[model samples]
Target: MDIIQLLEVLKPAKDVVTVQIASQKDPLTPWFDLAKAVLPAAATAFVAWRAMNRSHRQFEITSTRQAAEFDKNLAQQTKALRVQTQIATEIEIKKEECRNVRDTCAQYLSLALESNRYKNDFDLASEYILKGNTQFIEKRNVAHENYLESSRKTLSARMLLMTYLNPETSPSFFESIKNVDTSLVSSAPNFGGVVGKCLAECRMYIEKKQAEISTIATE
Candidate 1:
């Protein structure tokens, strides 16, 4: 109604308008909101990248350890294989040597038998000479020469066996061979039993060496 009353009502309205203006958003409010939203996502992405890197490093370490273990196992297998091969080779060589010895011993026995046959012929011719048969003198000389040659060959074969025989490893075989040698050279020689025993011992020795070779191959 009057100017003073209208001024009081208008003052209240002006104060309300001032408060609303002060509370209103600034011009940079949208940019601040965008930063807030982007910061959380960027932090999450950084954390994920770190986790992936750590996993990759762990994988690398595991792969390296596995590779090293594989190499060690392979080296050990190769060494074992090499050792087996070496042992097998040695066994084969020894087997061959045993065969040689067996063959040579048989040859010696054959020569000894031939020498005994020639000795009989020489003795028969000597008996004729003692009975005053002049024609038997040349035959006796020839038989004597043949007997000496056969004996020499037998001795040579026996010497060859001495090089191959091992008394320590093949004691029974060595003893059997000794008995055969003595029997063949003795005045009243017994050939049948001693010859059989020597050959049997040779067979057993060869069989034992063969078994060793088989074991090495399997391993």
Candidate 2:
């Protein structure tokens, strides 16, 4: 009951203590502690990275939209400026055309007046031919040539005016000019009145055309 009994009781308590020490010093214990310390920090870092990436994407999308809008506005402004320039250029061309037409009309009236001056000489020359006067033949020929040349110049100037004006729009003006030309031969009592009427009509038409050009420019 003395030494053997004491050894058996001591051996049971020693075995329990040895088992507890072996469990505490297990090979996987250090790995488990390291995982506990690092896992939460790694998870937080991943979440922050994902949030930053989403924010970057949103910023890029906003920037792209703004750039597209700016380009669209710029294109519209450029188109408007181009249209204005075209309108200005067209108005200048129309004004030049009006000036040419007015000049041609003046030339036509001048030629018609010159032709009227020759009408009396032509009538006299015809009388001499009827009377069979050979000495007056050369004088009659010269008067006839002058009349024909004046008439040709008047017609040419009228044709040049027609190139710039639409006949359908200014029928009265053209008709008045025609009446003046006819009066050159007939030597009508209303010759001066017809010339005056022609000038009035021409001036009216020119004013109308200029007004239209002004309207276009304002628009």
Candidate 3:
């Protein structure tokens, strides 16, 4: 080939290189920089959205747990209130039972007091047996002793009536008051006698049962 033909071919190849360099460096550079900025902003927005979504889910879970806890506490409190109401009702019933027993004991005491009317008569007649005098008074003393003995017998008989009401006293009794059940003797028993003790102990036992019931219910 001639030199002109070779020069022409070389010149065209150099123009293609300049055009490629201009394409790589000039027109797309601004677009690539804009893409870099937009991509980072989009990544930051997506990360923020995900963090907010996670936090919202955590809040929903926390709210559900709190609601469940509230329901459980409310149920326990209601159960305790119901048990307390039941115990209060039972206590009132037991107290009413104690009142009934007390009334029964009062009736028996009234009857015993009414039947002890012979005490005044025996008090006056017994002085004659302890005095000394002439033959006339001595004869009167024998009459007085007989009268006293009759009065004593009458008093003993009156007290024996308690056995009729209470079959527990069907056994022997001592006129000296040492062998009879204390219910027959008004001079010794504390509240009233065995009858009174029976009532009091029964009420006490019921009260003890009430305390036990309260403890068990709370547990």
Top candidate by TM-score: 2
| CA RMSD of each candidate after superposition | 7.4, 6.9, 12.6
lDDT per residue for candidate 2 within 1-219, as digits (tens), equals: 775566668786555433233435778889999999999999999999999999999999999999999999999999998998899888888788778878988898888888776766777888988899877788778888998999899889878877776669888987887788788768887777888898898889889879989899888
Q: How close is candidate 1 to the true structure, as a TM-score?
A: 0.64
Tell me the lDDT of candidate 3.
0.53
What lDDT does candidate 2 reach at residue 48?
99
Candidate 3 clashing pairs, residues 3+ apart or interchain? none
Q: Write the per-residue lDDT of candidate 1 for residues 112-160, one digit (tens) a residue.
A: 7787677778888999999999799999999989989998998898788
Clashes of each: 0, 0, 0
Give me the runs in candidate 2 sitting further than 4 Å from their true place: 1-52, 124-136
Report, for every candidate in turn, its global Cα lDDT versus the true structure: 0.82, 0.83, 0.53
Which scores better on lDDT, 2 or 3?
Answer: 2
Identify the superior model by TM-score, candidate 1 or candidate 3: 1
Query: Against the hidden true structure, what lDDT does model 1 obtain?
Result: 0.82
What candidate 3 gets wrong by more than 4 Å, as runs, is 1-31, 107-219
The CA lDDT at 200 in model 1 is: 87
Best candidate, lDDT: 2
